[model samples]
Target: MTAATFQWLTLVTLTALTFSVAETGLSGSSILIPVLLATLLKGRLVIDRFMALQGVSGPWRWVVLGWLLLVLGLIAYTFLYS
Candidate 1:
């Protein structure tokens, strides 16, 4: 299998897992944390693959990834604190 194929599969699997968790209709920190983590992974995949930032050896990749992490971290913190 090719790298692209593997990444596609990983994205699909992560999306399904997140969707299943949502369908459970249980919104607690414990459950939401996993969902958020899955979202973070999905975001990374998109930023790397769809955004064409993977293996580029530049600051742009880290900048984008850092932004993603910050956004997700705030979301998770809010969920946990509230």
Candidate 2:
């Protein structure tokens, strides 16, 4: 793997680990929402960077973007409505 890709993957992995720790420590309802969001964001960075998603064609990029948006929307609704 290229140096940049490897670096990105390492960063993403660290972010994921941090999020896991944060989730375990945070208990209140308000903190729960932010912790969950941080987890999702770390996942998004992995998919977008290490996966080389931005190098894909326009249509594929849009599809991935749509999926990301959908996921974020679901997360927002869940936290807001629950």
Candidate 3:
């Protein structure tokens, strides 16, 4: 399958997962795991596919991945600690 098609499917799946999380009445802390995982997956997909970073080399790719990790880490920290 094409990368775009795969990304689109992942997005749809993430949306459904979000809806399921909301409908299940789970606690906020418990819900953070899947939410964070989906966020990371989506970020990676966008970086590699849409941003065309898959074929590139060097520190730039790591920089973008690190940025994504940092943002997601902060989000998880706040979600868990607040």
Q: Using TM-score as the measure, which candidate wins? A: 1
Worst 10 residues of 3 by lDDT: 52-61
The lDDT values for all models are 0.88, 0.68, 0.87
- The TM-scores of all predictions, comma-separated, are 0.84, 0.55, 0.83
Q: lDDT (0-100) at residue 6 of candidate 2? A: 76
Residue 29 lDDT, candidate 3, scale 0-100 = 75
**lDDT at residue 11 of model 2 (Cα atoms):** 70
lDDT of 3 by residue, 1-82 (tens): 9869988898889879988997999977789988889889888888888888887988777899999999999989998998
lDDT of 3 at 74: 94
Task: Output the TM-score of candidate 2.
Answer: 0.55
Please name the candidate that would achieve the greatest lDDT relative to the true structure: 1
The best-first sequence of candidates by lDDT reads 1, 3, 2
The number of residue pairs in model 1 that clash at the backbone is: 0
Greater-lDDT candidate between 1 and 2:
1
| Residue-level lDDT for 25 in candidate 1 | 86
